[model samples]
Target: MAEITAAAVKELRERSGAGMMDCKKALAENGGDTEAAMDWLRTKGLAAAAKKSSRTAAEGLVGVAVAGTKGVAVEVNSQTDFVAKNEIFQSFVRDVTALAMDVNDIDALKGATMPQGGSVEDVLTANIATIGENQVLRRMKRIEVAQGAVIPYVHNAAAPGMGKIGVLVALESDAGVDVLEPLGKQLAQHVAAAFPLALDETGLDQDILERERAIATEKAAESGKPADIIAKMVEGSVKKFAKENALLSQPIVHDGKTPVADVVAKAAKDAGASIKLVDYVRFQLGEGIEKEESDFAAEVAAAAGISKG
Candidate 1:
């Protein structure tokens, strides 16, 4: 058996960002070979990441890219915000946004050619190897307007547009690009900050409405009012919920008084064009993931190699 020295373990630890004991174990398992130890660490990271796949990854980057009338928004997740700051990771996000403009589907984006001399999958694999961590291209959406423009907004950071959230809005009109593009971009930024649930009330999720109605009905029943009055209360509550949740029904973020739909209309009037907000896409990282609660006592006990007292 080859001897595993402290120096060898430390070197491997620096390369992998893994614990010292983990590096030592990898070196010991791989006959004290640095190259083999590196591979071992990478395999461990991949396994650890797989375990974390079901965990909420709310801290990641929302990236956007635009070319003329076409724009794309993508959300890429990482286990930690620190990884989001890595230059290679940021570059991967930038390229993924550009790829999104060309491919409408996630699978297509995965199979698309990567500029650094391989397919997207190949590049991802190489990045995992180089970064000593596992990464994924989570989801993407693309929008384009043949007549007007698809403007993009990324809030928080820029590796050419990687941030905490991203938005894309498509404006369809006969207006010239100079007049329409600026307005479209401003609206996109507004959408990012506002985080609207739907483009309009029509698109609001029925499940949410049902849930809201149930809550409202329970609250109204407690009032001991007549059945007709209770029904009216529930209906009124639902309307209020829908207006608050829906994108267009919500008051404009910019003015804090006008609805977003009205804001767009006013912009169209100023530009002297009949503009319509056909569609919009917003991606925020880690919105739905149920973050597992950590048991601090158990963790401390394990670290100390002692049974819980």
Candidate 2:
């Protein structure tokens, strides 16, 4: 049996970020071979990560990255907000967001290889083990423009391009970044604040519209109007709802008067180039995710193997 040197254990600990005892055991189990010990440690980490996967991870950061005419946003969630501030978690989010710029979807981003010689998912699993908390690469979105700018904005940033809210504005224009960037930023900020559901009325979900129409119909019936008048009232209400919720039809955030469509048109006229608000992505951290509500006393009691009478 090869003697497990202290130097070998320390090296493995540094490489794998495992507990010192675990590193010593890994090195001992692998005949003092660092490479094999690394693989062993990663296998243990994978198990640890799986154990943590059941914990709720509704807190973390939304990361954004932009390169010229393309941008991507990624949301990474952790078990607590404190983990979001950790440098390891932040670096992982940043690196994953940078990788997301080239991928079209979340699956692709997960499968994409990282500079550190592993897939993004693999790195994420390792992080979960070292951080000792559940984390998830919740979602990713990408936007691009042929000739214009895809600007990115991070609201309440925890780091450079990661925050609680991430927004991307895809401006399809013939103008350069100098002109399109500022306009895109304004639009992105509006998106972050206004929370538009879609680009236009046509882009709104059919289900949501149906629900709105049903509500309008019910309200109109309460007025005790004639059937024909009620029909007209319901239609008017649906149209008004769409106008208020759709991005292009909604009023701009600046003056609260001009429509967003008119704002883009005015910017185009000023820049002497045609600009189109082609697409956008807004990812608020843990949006729509149901979090697990845990009681601290119960958790402590459970950990202590104590049962309530």
Candidate 3:
């Protein structure tokens, strides 16, 4: 066995884009030879997988799972939507989502062990290499309530518990499942439909509030109203924006008039149990990633020495 120095591992990482531990192991297995270590990484498919890491992965599913009081949502992205329906890819997502309930966050979930073998990330890299598409374990979120239930809802479901929109609603109550489940399902549906920015005005981003304020002030200033009246008008506008964007203040999706907070209160009243909407999480597939718009015909024309136009 040869001694694996820090410099050797660093160089291997630079060459392979493999993690530090993997690079060190590669060096140790290859007798501290940089070239041999690089070979080992490529043979393991990790290097090949990392090479495709730069590709945009904006299509995939949002997987949701609930275990009693706790629920988790995980987004796994692939370069194309076709992979979203692939059994191998879908199985990985479902397993990862269930696994995410045991971990703290995305990093932990990736490092956590899967039932088959190796870390969640290891399987992911292997899948990427074999599947020949860039895949990303984008994010995971877990929600729980002490005395109540955490309900999961999947909209546009590709399978049982995974879909384009995954939502988890945590209710803190001693109410029976009979009452909590229906209420939670309704709220989760509303959450999917309404796309609330936050649970309440306080949870909303200050930057968002300020931006709305500025817009309202600009519009109101055009009215040429008195300063105090304009200030009041701006305040009202901002409040309306907050109410419209915050989940707790927004009108219920079904009836379209009752506020969410009031709906919860009414449910609690009817159930004869004190129910509180603790928290919720909504994960929409490819919510933030920018997708490329390519013109394949033009590229083919250019390559074939013909004009497309």
Top candidate by TM-score: 3
- lDDT (0-100) at residue 261 of candidate 3? 99
- For model 2, the superposed segments whose C-alpha errors exceed 4 Å read 1-57, 298-309
Model 3 is weakest, by summed lDDT over 10 consecutive residues, at 48-57
User: What are the per-residue Cα lDDT tens digits for candidate 2 across 1-309?
Assistant: 899977678656665668899988888889888766665665454212110111222899999999988899999999899999999999999999999988889999999998888999999999999999999998998888778889999888888999998999999999877888899899999998888889999998897788667757866787899999999998997898788889999898988999999999999999899999999998888876766666788899999999865
lDDT of each: 0.76, 0.85, 0.87
Q: Which stretches of candidate 1 lie over 4 Å from their true place?
A: 1-57, 293-300
Model 2 score (lDDT)? 0.85
Best by lDDT: 3
Q: What are the per-residue Cα lDDT tens digits for candidate 1 across 105-164? A: 989999999777688878888888988776778888888888788887777665567787
lDDT, residue 205, model 2: 88
Provide TM-scores for the models.
0.77, 0.78, 0.80
On a 0 to 1 TM-score scale, where does candidate 2 land against the true structure?
0.78
Residue 264 displacement in candidate 2 (angstroms): 0.6
lDDT of 3: 0.87
Itemize residue pairs with steric clashes in candidate 1.
Answer: 58-286
Q: Per-residue lDDT of 55-164 in model 3, one digit per residue for the tens?
A: 23278999999988999999999988899999999999999998999999899999999889999999999999989998999999999988899999999899999988
Candidate with more favorable, higher lDDT: 2 or 3: 3
